[model samples]
Target: MNAEARNARWNVLGLLPAQLIMLATLIVPVGIIVLVSFSTRGPYGGFDYVFTTAPYRQILFNEGWTGELEFNPQYLIVVARTMILAAATTFICLLLSFPVAYFISLQKATAKMLLIYLVTLPFWVSMIVRVYSWIIILGNDGVIAKTLHALGLVDNMGSLLFTDTAMLIGLVYSYIPLMILPIFASIEKLDPALVEASHDLYGSRLTTLRRVILPLCRPGMMAGSILVFVPCLGAVLEPILLGGGKTMMMGNLIQLQFGAARNWPLGAAISIVLMAAVLVFLVWRGLRAIRRERAEAAA
Candidate 1:
């Protein structure tokens, strides 16, 4: 056999193990969830073998005794709320990450490494522990509440915990590192000559950022957005802990179905829906990236 053909065969053989692992771990579990989504609920809260569309219908409508379909907004509201929370978190992270990334990118080598380490330092701790720390900081008798009271901003130690603001704070804190790393990577690779040229042309700093830096950083921003948004949509811990279970996100709803509600089929259906939505978003982003690359090449 030719050397090229032998090399190709070896490459495929090298990838075979990873392909099998992915199939076993990801594909199999997702396939099981999809199958369960179309199943019927048994008398005792488990799934039955019978196939049915009732779980999907439950997400969209209320069925009358006589089988009339009435539009229901309960699950719809949850989905919308999830989307809004995810989108807002992604946007906030994007805004916050850029400046930090830019600063890091401009730093000397030692300082840059130190700054990058600091940015990722939070990951060394367990996520649950990190979230719990916010509870102490935002609690009624915590630093924020005491400071507010001391400043006469409040009559008492008003807690920031268990509010939407608290939830958002946790989400942003948890995901900001994910956002920053990608942006920093992009900015690090950016040609300094481009910035120098823009300045030589007498472009203002803001103008340069808007016209040059942002365009070059688009891929990183998109990557960071996807990383933040998708996971935020399915986040249960932050909403539950910070929002005090008062807020109902899609993840919380799914957890409820599987745990308290004891409806496996419904939970599986919700999981499927969430996965499909994420898949659609990924496809859209991927297509946009491809188009942008094509445009850049043509230019």
Candidate 2:
């Protein structure tokens, strides 16, 4: 056989193991979930192997006392809250990350390395540990409350731990690194000459930033936003510990179905629905990216 053909065969052989692993680990589990989502729940809270769409229907309507399907907005509210919080987390992360990334990108080599290391230092500890630290900081006798009392800002120590603000803080802290790294990589690729030219053209710093830097950084920002947003949609730990279980999100709802609710089909259905929503979003973004590339090519 020719050398090129021989090399191609070897490359395909090398990829076989990874392909099989993905099939076994990823695809098989997802296939099982999909099948389970369509099956009815057993009398005792497991798969019944009976075909039905009741689980999917249960998302929007619950069975009423008269055995009729009635419109229910409880699950819908959880879905909305999940979307809102995820969007807010993405926006906050973007805002916080861009400045840190830009600062890191502009630093001297050794300083830049140190700053990047600091940015990622939180990852060295377990996430649960990090989250627990926040619980201490936001608790009634925690740092913020104690400091406020010392400053005479409040008459007494009041807790910040069980609020939406605390949850947002935790989410942002958890995912901000994901946002920063991508934007920093993009900023590193930027040419200093471009900014210098903008300045030479009598452009104010703000004007130059808005016109030149932001456009160039768009790709990284989008990627970072996606990284933060998608995971936030399914975040469980922050909402539970930080929000004190007062707030319910899609992830928490899914956990309820599988755990206390004992409805495997419903949980599987919610999982499928969430996956479908993410898939749709990805497809939309892919199409928009393709269109932008074509337009740029034409330009």
Candidate 3:
């Protein structure tokens, strides 16, 4: 065979193992969940062999004993809340990450490496431990409260934990690195001469950022937004720990269904729905990437 053909064959061979692993780990489990979503709930827990649409119906509507369907908003509200929180987290992460990423990108190689390491230092700790640390820091008697009380900012150690604000703070803190890394990747590749040219033309820093840097970093921003938003949509630990079990997100609801509620079918259905939403987002991103590539090629 020719050199190109032999290389192509080798590439396919190299990918075969990964393909099999993905099929086994991801595709198979998702297929099982999709199948279970259509099945009937058993007497105690788990699911029965009988196929039914009751789970989906229950998510969207309430059925009376007489079989009259009424619109239900409970699950929809949970989904909406999840989406809102995820979006908010993504926005906050974007705002916080941009400056940090730009600063890192502008640093010398050694300094950049150290800054990157610091940015990712939290990952060295266990996620659960990091989250628990937030609990201590944000607790009423924790550092913030103590500092505030010492300064006489408040009459008491006011509650900061177990609130939506606390949950948002945790989400932003946890996901900010995900946002920063991508933007830094993009900014590091940017041509410094372009910034010099803009400045030579007497462009202000804010103007250059708006017209030059942001446009160039759009891909990284989009990637970071998706990375932050998708997982935030399915966040469980932050809501449970920080919100004090009062905030119910989609992930928390799914956990409850599978654990406490003992409704495997419903849980599977919710999982399927969440997966579908993520798939939709992925497809949208893929299409946008393709179009952008085409536009760049055309230009």
Q: What clash pairs does model 2 have?
A: none
Off by over 4 Å in 3: 64-68
Whole-model alpha-carbon lDDT for candidate 2? 0.93
Every candidate's lDDT: 0.93, 0.93, 0.92
TM-score of model number 2? 0.95
Query: Which regions of candidate 1 fall more than 4 Å away from where they truly are?
Result: 64-69, 151-157
Clashing pairs in 1: none
lDDT of 1 at 2: 100
Task: List, residue by residue over 1-299, the lDDT tens digit for candidate 3.
Answer: 99999999999999999999999999999999988999999877889889999988878988766888988788989999999999999999999999999998888999999999999999999888989998999998888998888999887866899999999999999989999999999998889899989999999999999998899999899999999999998899999889898958999999988888888989999989998998898999899899999999999
List runs of model 2 lying over 4 Å from the truth.
Answer: 1-11, 65-67
What would the per-residue lDDT of candidate 1 be over residues 176-205, giving only the tens digit for each residue? Answer: 999999999999889989999999999999
Q: Give each model a TM-score.
A: 0.95, 0.95, 0.95
lDDT of 2 by residue, 31-149 (tens): 99999999999877889889999999999999788998899888889988999999999999999999999999989999999999998899899999999899989999899998889
After best superposition, candidate 2 residue 139: deviation in angstroms?
0.7
Local error of candidate 3 at 20, Å? 1.0
What is the alpha-carbon lDDT of model 3 when measured against the actual structure? 0.92
Worst 10 residues of 2 by lDDT: 153-162
Local error of candidate 2 at residue 293 (angstroms): 0.8
